[model samples]
Target: MSQTRFGNQIKQATLTPFEKEVIDGCLLGDGTLTKSGKEYRLRIEHALKDREYVSWKFEKLKRLCISDVQYVSNHDSTRFGTVGHPEITVLRQKWYRPVKQVPEDLVLTPIMLAIWFMDDGTKHRDTVDISVHSFSEQSLHLLQKQVSLLGIKTTVNSDGKGKRLYILKKSYPSFKRLTKPYILKCMERKLP
Candidate 1:
């Protein structure tokens, strides 16, 4: 009964399998799961124009959130955060070691890739670019390898800012097919 109340907070919120999938996708993008002592909380922020997107995410993980999404006037962004949870702490520890890195044991799923695409993917003339600038060269290589396991091929390129994984033109069909099912309607504009 402890977690039954509509607005009541759980002492140690347990994440659902779907929620874990959400977190994994977010970690690959800009979302931060911060650790304090033994607890970790996920914070999601996006442009005010993306309020609907963040709201969608909020709805998916509402059980862990104590408050509704907030508008940050300074950044002109919408943001929300989850309450601390030990389950989240485990993920943070696995994905972050001083700085974010691709988890060695990661297994990408369609929904997870869709979330990541919505977060960082951009469509080019004949390719898709997923910004992985924050990751080291080694981490990016590992990510490329992981993506290949699904039969999609990609290459890492570096520009003025940093590295990004470019889904080759030939693989666009496969990429689209794999991620389209999980792509949110609001983010369909990003696809070719």
Candidate 2:
């Protein structure tokens, strides 16, 4: 059967406020919205060391999933000389679009920023780097604008790979104040 046709069995549902906050943050970070033909799915994966974190996310999203979250052991004997850490995937065929072009109706909150930082943000010496290299220049600009609306300033830079958004030094205090409360204890390292 076609993936789109098969996947259509799962209906799209509206997200609750809390769900929207968390999932939107996730999408801004490592969460991906993918399509196969006409099927759109949300995919989230994390290393086994983050089992608890992923499990926590699974719990928050399980109601919308067509199947249970699956745990898989990742192996790269050639590269790392041994089977590597485990990981988990929480996949669901939902109708949400990608975060690059955020929906107007969806609200962006500090909690979402915190979650996104947990996913793709790294603490630099005096600035925070949001790994948005996978996004296009236009998308990165949109993200910057969105963040700017929160009173934080961001600049886009291109490394060898792609473009990334840097939370400027001046924005450090605002960024820390906004995302601190939402950061989990395990993800404290992401904080500036």
Candidate 3:
């Protein structure tokens, strides 16, 4: 059905449980919640080489999208950070508003953690690195505490990129056990 059919059919359907967790993770990662005029959308863009991953996410979110996901080649002016790989865009939903700070409504779950890890977490020799430099120190600290509530200890550190968060080596096993089941096969390499 077309997105124009927003009468009763569309209103009847809301984000499924899995979709909710994925959106939570997307928000914590590179995905952006933005607006066009009055409508808000969740925008996710990834390199073309990761087309399969993008496609998988699209499949999971197709019900909320206005149109099919498209792979668009980015020119020099449009390159995000690096160039060469074409990018795919998966935009869906019209109710997600951009937040100035971390939202209290977010209930971080294991699946959400896995998605965020696949998106921005890095595996290091002795610790697990999570790139949260885009967030403020206060936000990072809050996140660290939130993770700690799950019994996983985390620390915030500063780098050239700003503030980054890390799951201590001692917490790696707990973190792994929490998020491993939800991680996608393609992103397995990101885990310890």
Candidate 4:
């Protein structure tokens, strides 16, 4: 999808208050609905800095169960100041879904498999790094803390190399129902 088209889709897609604000800030300006055409970095930074922003977006996206969020990069610099020229191409937000079945030899949980799918999917593999190392042990710890804070009960393996594994003792039916929207929200908050 073209950048303009993707931007339009973000504008038209149903979003939470936080999602709307972030997208609007990126496509438009902070206080205006008119397209700024150059605020991608600023908007992304703003959204990431706000804790509620990312959480809200993630929840909404997971609920929607959207396969991806596509957009284009208009900036010339990386978010981390790397020497890279941003391409004016589609940016996809790949969603993670638990695999119902896998080979018995592979000791992986549904969540782990889902995360793998999101990172390995051809559409986003080149654009985003979803590798196991990318997940980070620190991030997993943070996720565990967050999940606890949110009152979501699950058993997470405390020992792991990079991304720790989390196994829900009592499966939440609601989780399946909310996966789409939750993922979308996550992308909104996490994506630049």
Q: Which stretches of candidate 2 lie over 4 Å from their true place?
A: 1-13, 34-39, 66-69, 75-107
- Per-prediction TM-score, please? 0.90, 0.71, 0.79, 0.28
Which has the greatest lDDT? 1
lDDT of 2: 0.63
lDDT of 4 at 52: 45
Residue pairs with colliding backbones in model 1 are none
The parts of candidate 1 lying over 4 Å away from their true place are 1-13, 35-38
Of 1 and 4, the candidate ahead on TM-score is 1
lDDT tens readout by residue for model 3, 113-143: 7777777888878667888867766567667
Cα lDDT tens digits, model 1, 1-68, are 33335323453556778888988998899799875445788999999988999999899888887689
How displaced is residue 185 in candidate 2, in Å?
1.5
Q: Which of candidates 2 and 3 reaches a greater lDDT? A: 3
Better of 2 and 4 by TM-score: 2
Against the reference, the lDDT scores of all candidates come to: 0.84, 0.63, 0.64, 0.30
Off by over 4 Å in 4: 1-16, 20-132, 156-164, 177-192
* Ten contiguous residues minimizing lDDT sum, candidate 1: 2-11
Total clashing pairs for each candidate: 0, 0, 0, 27
Q: Point out the higher-scoring one by lDDT: 3 or 4.
A: 3
Better of 2 and 4 by lDDT: 2
RMSD of model 2 against the true structure = 8.1
Which parts of model 3 have CA positions greater than 4 angstroms off?
A: 6-12, 75-99
Answer with 1 or 3, whichever has the higher TM-score: 1
